[model samples]
Target: MVQQVQEVAQTGDNSGQDLVLSHVTKRFSDFVAVDDLSLTIPAGSFFALLGPSGCGKTTTLRMVAGLEQPSSGTISIGGRDVTSLPSHQREVNTVFQSYALFPHMSILDNVSFGLKRRRVRNPDAMAKEALEMVELGHLAARKPVQLSGGQQQRVALARALVNRPAVLLLDEPLGALDMKLRRQMQVELKAIQTDVGLTFIHVTHDQEEAMTMADTVAVMNKGRVEQMGDPRELYELPRTAFVANFLGKSNLMRGPITEDLGDAVAVDVSGVRVVLPKSRSAAHAGSAVVGVRPEKMRILDIDDAAYSPTANQLVGRVVDASFTGIITEYIVDVPGVGMVGTFSQNLGQRPAAPGERVRLLWEPEFSFGLPGDEEPAEGTDAV
Candidate 1:
């Protein structure tokens, strides 16, 4: 499949076609859907625009696809201004969530429709190769109704790939699939992007989907980017409370900065002094919100010998514990802190039950600090 796609890729040079959006903003009278957004997507990379609904990710994608014009600023592809160009004129194709395959047309004809419209020679052959690239050539004779949801999605993808656009836009293309199939498609879509070497800008609200398939992820919130970077980096060191809470579960400890230790800053959390690495902190002098992921914390008995004296520790009573196969999730409530969550790997030992007093400990370096003024509930509701 990969070799076949590479052969088709030789038909055109799709490399080095960077998609650049400069200070783009889109407004509908009173509502600003996308605000002063500027992004440079490198060629041949899989990038994801991730956010909750109405965060302007879809608006940004529409502007890139020429479906919606930006109220202001320029949209360019490969140094050429394409801001005013219609969707058809731009070197881009979009695979929508609806699949949009012609119900009556055979899969091969459906895939070949765009090529035929553009007067490309041997459209059927090209489309067949595309089907094979997606490993759907054997189903060419079937109609859309005859194929399953996952197969129909592949047909839609092949239809878009047959056009051989420099940039491909995926707008929640896997939203219709079940959980297991969605995960399967994520891997396949990433592999297809690598095989074709086309710049793919995926817009999705699913955090796992964005993190799994994209080489770079831009987390947008309320028409602006909260953070953008490699998925691992963004997860490890979130710059804002929204990113910390939205990307995954984070326990935020808000307090004043008591001292700066050159390499780390000390914050008093409910009378417990916790240290955060200076490089990981977005706040320096004023009060800060310290954050750590649930998986980074361990629930230990107060007298556990494994407890390190230097580690950040918070004592709390277990409110609830839910065992989910590989890991047990616990909700612990402390006197000063409202509620803190922890995930302990199930290693054939009994989990700490409810009402039991436990200590949550994590390495100080694992902590990240954000501005104290940022709302702790900013991105919690969206999840």
Candidate 2:
């Protein structure tokens, strides 16, 4: 049996949010794309719809943009339902991943294209203002092919923001840029959003992008929203196995509760035991999974590891170690915990090398129950 839902009352100030998706679904023949999804995005907030390909993330965003018509349910912008509205009629603008800029048109002309179509009184003046907003005023006359990938992206952003819509939707806008440029654009995008005070709903399958730029993250799976919360909450207190495994690195331990209370439970996990803070039920108390983040695992030298607690100690042989500049990652093969990934604090140099034996420890508070999925066995202590 799954745990009962915890009741939390809603408040009024929540209604003034910019985007609302209520039981919104998109279907193609019989295949359901967006499945009765409901969500509220506040104004001036940067929100991300994150999932793997074909997980309905893009479909949900498209429904918001009025690009892909929903088969059922309603979508609203700034509080009014616009389920039947056309893309152009909604107070929303989108920047596609392809840049979608006219190749021959100059940067200024491309930005002005949307305003011109809407028959704005002074399209040139508005285009100049938009170009200046993106710091592209100096490059206004340059063609799309003439600008670098990062510059081109800025122009694309300028085009979308120029309309001054109520909400801006981005569909993998950074997917085209190289790693360095992508990193730069992430900061720039967040800065621009904060400055403009506009609601941004971004769609991406990239984990780092979702965490870094967006104020809140909504992780999706299968055609439904698996979890929705701030990035810190989603990563630290993942409620489901899919969320734990998908969002970040996790060591999942399978077992069942030996004792239970209303608010907490003691679980027997692979011969080890841990007391989880939150109460959970899984069918019977016979089986469940505990997810622990890699960073939560503390690394200790063999001597320092001697006194580790019975509930959390794990001895493992390091299969591989790689330095990633800021932090070093290691693949540790542990006996009861399996092969779990971990990281060490960067102190200017890497501490452990490949083939080293190490021990990692944490506590019961670090563990949480996940309903399904179990990994294979691994580990042998070899220095």
Candidate 3:
């Protein structure tokens, strides 16, 4: 199946291409896999589509790759409409989770297969350069079965890259590797993409993988995009509770609006007041959900010590303490609300033991507000 890609002619256009999807959607029977999704991936930019399984991320990638046709809308590559084009005619290459290398062929032969079929001159020389790009030039004589998992994965990458397609689509390409090798490959993949200056559209369910490799990330939910931005922007100011919880660990507290100060609003969470800036939220005065990341919160020893009137503080009894190498995670039980988790670095103060009373301190600016009762689109919980 992989060798069939070699039969397609290599496009002469050498420039990188921007991918644009306008109101693209896919429907399977009565189920809509993707819904009115529009995105713009700039030329030479590394972008990631991230979500849990069955969130339409893979379906969206398939639409762009011409593997799956959209029920409605159009897809354009480099300002040329290619929605109706076949996969072989789209000038795009895909590297999937499976290496799919030819076990009977040598590494160099595997890399040159596509070029040879396209009638490119000096296929062996071009293939050697591609192998060198992946730091596997020395292993050209080895067969697929002779190489380790990482080396085989690199050979697969070399195969895809030898054609120099306008866009490179990666669908969880590191999912098959172990944790250590996967981390190593993530760095190498991003570095290679930078060196080649190609537009890379990667789809992955791992948040860390997307955050580490891509310059921009789009978090998908159900059939639509929930949030899209740089890793820092999305992590710091999640627009919705789902983004807050799914992207990373967050403590969500629901409360009624007590004070509206235009730029900021104070919410009363079970007799405790917390202020969040309005710019980080779309919710007005009423009920809202305030989110604070576990790392942003600090655990301070409190023994009948009154906190400052203006400070954001939550008094809780420590119920559990867990040491996770560089940091210690503490689960505290607040009075009205349930358990709230916080992480403290192991560099400084020792972790408080269970049953110890502590105060959670965090800046008001760290909190993000969102509508408490906002109903997400249909099937939003698929993640």
Which candidate number maximizes lDDT?
1
Candidates ranked, most accurate by TM-score first? 1, 3, 2
Q: How does candidate 2 fare on TM-score?
A: 0.86
Residue pairs whose backbone atoms clash in candidate 1: none
**Clashes per model (N, Cα, C within 3 A):** 0, 1, 0
Task: lDDT for model 1, please.
Answer: 0.92
Report the CA-based lDDT of candidate 2 relative to the real structure.
Answer: 0.78
Candidate 3: worst-modelled 10 consecutive residues by lDDT: 1-10
Prediction RMSDs, each to the true structure: 1.3, 8.3, 4.3
In Å, residue 332's CA in model 2 sits off its true spot by 2.4
**lDDT tens per residue, model 2, 224-282:** 99889989888887777677777877777777667765576767766666666664333
Q: Score candidate 3 by lDDT.
A: 0.86
lDDT of 1 by residue, 1-383 (tens): 77789766546887778999999999999999999999999999999999999999999999999999999999999999999999999999999999999999999999999888989899999899999998999999999999999999999999998888889999999999999999999999999999889899999999999999999999999899989999999999998888888898999989999999999999999998899899999898889999999999988987787777764889999999999999999999987878999999999877899999999988988899999898776799744
Off-target runs (Cα >4 Å) in candidate 2 are 1-17, 260-264, 279-287, 301-306, 346-357, 372-383
Q: Give the TM-score of candidate 3.
A: 0.92
**Residue 137 accuracy (lDDT) in model 2:** 90
